[model samples]
Target: MPDLFLLNISASSIFDAASPEAASIRQLTFEFIIAASAVLLLVVILTSYITVKYRSKHRHEDPKQITGNRALEIWMVSVPLALVILFLFRSLATMNAILPDRGNHTPDIIITGHQWFWEASYPGTTVTTANEIHLPTGKRILMLLNAADVIHDWWVPALGPKMDMIPGMNNYLWLTINQPGIYDGACSEFCGQQHAWMRIRVIAQLQPDYERWLSEQTTNTHIPQDTMAKAGAILFLESTCSSCHRLKGTAAAGITGPDLTHFGSRQTMLTGMMANDSGNVARWLSDPQAVKPGAHMPRFIFAKDSIRALTAYLEQLK
Candidate 1:
C-alpha cells in the first residue's frame, strides 16, 4: 500500500514546468517520501517481529515484563528529532528560495482579484487584461496582488505556492516558468456565489512572442469598429459603468471595477467565471444579479437594447 501510494503521487505531473520554485518543491517532496517510507517500514517490521516472537503456547508461562530500554528510547527520540530538524531546514530553504528578493530584477505586474474575475495590469505599459496573464518564459514575475471588493487567492500549482489577495493590503510572490505553456489555476478563496467559477490561465511564452502580444495589447485596434461597440461605448460612457471601469483613450475612467480597455482581448471574462464570448458578456451586462448573484455590479436589465449594443462594443475591444 505504501509503495502504491508513493508511486501514484510520484506519477502525477507535478514537475512539468521545471521552474526554480518547482525544483525546490520537488526536492522537499523527495526528502519527505524517503523519510516517511523509512518510518513506515520500520513500524511494520517491528510490529510483525513482536507478534511472532511473543506468541505463547504454555498455560503456566508468564509473559516477561520489560521496562523501558534507555538505548532504544534514546535512539527513537534522536532519530525522529534529527528527521524533523532536517525537514524544517528543507522547508525554510524552499520558502526563502521561492520568495522574491528586493534587489532581484523581478517584473512587476499588478493584479486585482474581484468577486469572480482576475484583473492584471502593467503600469509602465498601461495594459490591462483579465483571466489570462502572459509572461516571458524563464524570467521571474513579481505580482503585486490585491482585491478590489473581496478576498481572492493567486494560485498556480505548477509554478509555485499560493498567495492571498486581500483588500486594502498588498501580497506578493515571485515565479518563473521554464517554458512556453498554458497552466490552469483557480482562485483558492471563496469570495461569493461564483467562487467556484473563479479560474485563471497562466500563459508563459517565448520572449519575442510575449513582447509582440504586449505591443499588440497596448495598441488600440478599434478601427472600422462595429456600430454596436461604438454605440455601446457611448452608452457605457453615460452609464454607471464609467464610474467603476477605466478605458484608456476614452471617457470611461474609474477604478472601482475591472478595467475594460482591452477586455475583448482576454480569453475569459467575469473574473474567469465565464467565457469571453459575446453571449456571456451580453447576459452578464443585461442582468449580473441573475447570472451571478451577489455580484457587486448592479443589474441593467432595463436597458436591453443599449446593453446589447454596449456588450457588442465591449466584445470588439480585441
Candidate 2:
C-alpha cells in the first residue's frame, strides 16, 4: 500500500525468440482451440439442421440406427495422432534450446534457494544479492538453481516453466528477456507455512541500466540523504535480526535470513513471495509470525522512533 514502490511482475519480450519449444506450445494451444471450436460449431449446426429437417410431418416409421462409421473413426484417431506428434516434435526442439550447454550462452548469475528466501551469487563476479534478480535484456542467462532446505520449485510463468530446486541436487534453466521489464516468479511446490510468501522478481533492463545496477550492487553505494534507510539499517543491526540476515556494507551479517542488501529496489519481497513496499516490509518487520506463522524471521518490536528510522533505512536500499 505504500506509494513508494509499484508492482509489475509480468513477462517481457526478452524471452520471445522463436524456439521450437515455444513454437510448439503456441501451436498446440492454437490447434486445441481450433479443434474445439470446429467441433462445437459442427455440433450446433448439425443439431439445428436435424431439429428442423427431421420434423414429424406424418406417422413415421422407425429411424435408422447406426453403430459406427469407419471413416469417422479413422479421422478421429489420425487427427489426434498427427497433432500429438507435431506437438512432441516441437516440444523436444524447444527442450533442447533450454537445456544447459546447448549453445554458446553465458549465465548472468547463479541463484540458490533457501527456506522462504532465495540467495543469488554471481560466480567469478564480486556480486551477490537476494530476492530480486537483474539481467540484461536480449541476452540469454542460465539460472543454476539449488536448494538449501527442502524441495522447492522456481517458476516464472511468462518466462518459462518451473524447475525444481532440491537440496544436494542442482537444476538449471535458461531465460532471455526481449525487453526491459520485471517478471514475477513463485515457488510452485509447497514447503512450509510461509511457502506462499516465497516469491521472486526477474528484472530485465537495458544494457546501460543493467550495468549501472551491477556497478551499484558491486560497490558500497549509499545515499547520504536517505536518512530513513540509514536508520532502518541501524535498527536491523541493533535488533536480533542480525542473527539471520546479511546486508552488504552493514554490520548485520547473519546468513540465517534473507539478504537485505538492495532490499528496497526489489519488486517483490520474501523471495519474490510478497510485494516489495514500505508497508509490507514494515508489516513483516512488525509481526512476521502473523503473516508467516512458521517464519524463521522474528518480529522486531521497535520503538516509534526506531521503527521510522528502520523503515527509512530499508527504503533507501533502492
Highest-lDDT candidate: 1
lDDT of 2 by residue, 1-318 (tens): 442343444542324423233344455557667866877898899999999998888957867888999999999899879867876786676666556463554455777777788788876677788877788877667778889989888876656657899999977777676667777667878888778878767777898998898887876535437666666666677778777777777677788776777777766676644566677777777787876788787666667677677777776776
Off by over 4 Å in 2: 1-24, 39-76, 100-106, 221-235, 249-251, 271-280
Could you tell me the lDDT of residue 26 within candidate 1? 75
lDDT of 1 by residue, 43-136 (tens): 9999999988877766586767888899999998999999899889889888888884656554478888987678888768968876788878
Error of 2 at 311 (Å): 2.9
Best by TM-score: 1
Among all windows of 10 consecutive residues in model 2, the one with the lowest summed lDDT is: 12-21
- lDDT (CA) per prediction: 0.77, 0.71
TM-score of each: 0.84, 0.76
- For model 1, the run of ten residues with the poorest summed lDDT: 2-11
